[model samples]
Target: MSLDDRQLLRYSRHILLDEVGIEGQERLCASHALILGAGGLGSPAALYLASAGVGRITLIDDDTVDLTNLQRQIAHTEARVGQRKVESARAAMLQINPEIRIDTLAQRADATRLRELVATADVALDCSDNFATRHALNRACVAHGVPLVSGAALRFAGQVSVFDTRPDAQGERGPCYACLFPEEAPAEEVNCATMGVLAPLVGLVGSLQAVEALKILSQAGNTLRGRLLLIDALDAEFQTVTLQRNPACPVCGHLTAA
Candidate 1:
């Protein structure tokens, strides 16, 4: 995809970077990203991906925008309250870059739909606020051999990680989301609606998710593959921990065995 004069000017900052020169910028302009959920996390992720010139972005969410979502879901507006999340987000993304394509799915991301979407996406982002949706997206990415950028935020804490199922040159596959948080684990469900999250925490984590997705798509730099990033907003601390793929993980373990 050759960048026209207008595109080159619009993406001049990215093209100026040595890591993301003309070639990397072009890669971003040709990549497709699938985003699940258009809430807090998806807001920044979608906004940045569009502003960065990702060619196509598909956003899926069944819910409608509410007054509460305005605290962190930046893609929505007061006028869009009660509108479908995917529609709200689509309008915001296109506002950033009208040249890019935005697909809005005002429906739940079920197993069948996720599998099909992941198969066509260059990268899939798990921006959903719940474990069920996260697990489903992870499974589809694993099955389709697509990279997954997962993010979550609650209270003043947040975490983001990238799970690339594709094997590296050494034939080693990175851990999937299930490897980090098992589906059967006795984990309590926490969300911004109940726990009261700081407005910027979601922005911090979601922005990181977008950064990782862009890096993976453009092959610009090393991503958080097999690594977890933890952010403590109250203490203003950041931590990165190494992650190992669980050979017994029900989702991606079979690939290792095969």
Candidate 2:
């Protein structure tokens, strides 16, 4: 695909980068991303991807905008309090880049729907607040061989990682999300409603998710594959942990290989 005059100007900065030249920008323009949740993390991630010229973005969320969302959900305005979160987010994304096509699914990300959505997406981002949905998304992405970029933030802490079951250039398969956190493992259910996340904390992590998603789509830079990046807003420090796939992982067992 060739970049038209308008597209070249729209992505001028990206095209000028040594890491993301014209070819890379074209890849981004032809990519499709599915974002789960239109809340804190999804808000910024969706906006950035739209602005970056991702051809299609599908956002899934059942929630509505509330006054409390103003702190971290940069995509929604105070006036949109009663509107569906996806509606508010879509408006903001279109305002940023009218050239991009966006689809909004105002529903929860259940296992069945998640599987269908992941099957058609090039990459999926898990910005959902609950562990159940996150687990569902991970399983779906792994099954479909779609790259998954997962991020979470609560209180003052956040984490980001990528799971791509697809083999790398050297024929090495990266660890899937379930490989790091087994399905049977107990995970805390953290939410902004109860835990109270810092306003900018979500943006900090979500924007990073956007960057990782773009890199994965364009195949330009080294992503956080099989590694977890932890962010401590209170301490303002960042840490990385290497992740290994469990040989006995049920999700990646011979019966369910991606």
Candidate 3:
């Protein structure tokens, strides 16, 4: 799949990078990305991925835009308040890159539906706002052997990481999301509404998620597969820590390395 003249011009900046030259750009232009949310984090993630020329994107969300969401969810406009979130996000993404395909599903995806969706996605982004959905996505990604880029933001704090259990050249794989935060041991669940998130924090984290997803799809740079990136908006600091896969991880432990 070669880039046409227009695509070359559109992705000239990415092609200039040695990491993402012509070959890498083509990979990105052929990849399929599944985004599981259309809220604060999903807004920027969808925007960037569409701008970056990911060929196909499937956005799943059951929520509707509200006046209060304008503070952080950039994909929704005030005029779209009563519209479904997936429709709003699709409109926002198409505005940037109409060449790409954006599939919108305005329904809450269950576990079975997640497995079906994950089966076809090259990579999945966890922008969902709850523990249950996050855990379910992790399980589905693990079962399907798809890479999952997870991001979360609340208040002045945020975190982003890649959970890819696929084996590397050395047959070693990174930890799944369950390895870091197990479902059985649930953390104190929080969201922007209850915790009052910093508006820009989610944008930063979601953009980071887009970066990781692009890397994985393009096979360009080393992804944050085994690293957890922690961001502190109050102090304006960023940190990355190595993550070790838990052998007893409930979601990914049973399967042998691929």
Candidate 4:
């Protein structure tokens, strides 16, 4: 894909980077990203992806924009409080980059829908708030061999990780989400609604998720494929832990064995 004069100027900052020059910018323009949820994490993730000129974005969320969401859900506004989250996010994303395509699905992320979307996506972002949705997306991404960038934030804590299930040239697969957090584990459904999250925590995690997604799509730099990043906003500390694929993982264990 060729960038015209206007596009070149629009993305001049990206093109100026040696790592993300014209070729990388074009790669970004041809990539497709699947994002789950349209809340805090998805807001910044989708915004950066769209602003970076990602060619296509498909966002899924069943909830509507509530007044309470305005605190951290940057994609929604006072005027869109009653609108569906996906619709509101799409509006915000398009407002940033009208040239890119944004698809909105105002529905929950189910296995069937996730499988279909993951198959078409170059990379998937698991920004959903609930464990059910996260595990569902992880399953779909592993099944389709797509890269999954997951992010979560609540209270003053946040976490981000990338699961690149696609095989390398040597047929080596990276650790999946299930390897880190097994699906069979008991549900610990804590969210911002109950815990009262810091407004910037989600933004920080979501923006990092976007950076990893762009790196995967544009082949710019090393991604956090097998590392988990943890953030403590209150203490202003960051930590990274190495991850390994579990041979007994229900999702990607077979790949490791093979």
Between candidates 1 and 2, the TM-score winner: 1
* lDDT of the candidates, in the order given: 0.93, 0.90, 0.94, 0.92
Expressed as tens digits, the lDDT of each residue in 159-216 for candidate 4 is: 9999987776677788999899999988779988888999989999999999999999
Root-mean-square deviation (CA) per prediction:
1.2, 1.5, 1.0, 1.2
Candidate 1: tens digits of C-alpha lDDT, residues 1-258: 899999999999999999999999999999999999899999999999999999999999999999999988999999999999999999988888999999889989799889999999999998997888889999999999999999998899999999997888788899999999999998888887788999989998999999999999989889999899999999989999999999999999989632
lDDT of 3 by residue, 95-205 (tens): 999999999889989888999999999999999999889888999999999999999998999999999999998888889998999888948877778879999999999
- In Å, residue 18's CA in model 2 sits off its true spot by 1.7
Candidate 3: where are CA atoms >4 Å away? none
- What TM-score goes with each of the models? 0.98, 0.97, 0.98, 0.97
Among these predictions, the greatest lDDT belongs to 3
Candidates, ranked, lDDT:
3, 1, 4, 2
lDDT of 2: 0.90
* Model 2 clashing residue pairs (backbone): none
Instruction: Write one digit per residue (lDDT tens) for candidate 2, span 1-258.
Output: 899999999899999998999999999999899999899999999999999999999999999999988988999999999999999999999999988889999988689989998898999999998878888998898788899999989899999999887877776677877788777888777687987989899999999999999999888889999899999999999999998867677776543333
Superposed by TM-score, candidate 2 places the C-alpha of residue 215 at a distance from the truth, in angstroms, of 0.2
Q: What is the lDDT of residue 169 in candidate 4?
A: 63
- Note the residue pairs that clash in candidate 1: none
Which residue runs does candidate 4 get wrong by more than 4 Å? 256-258
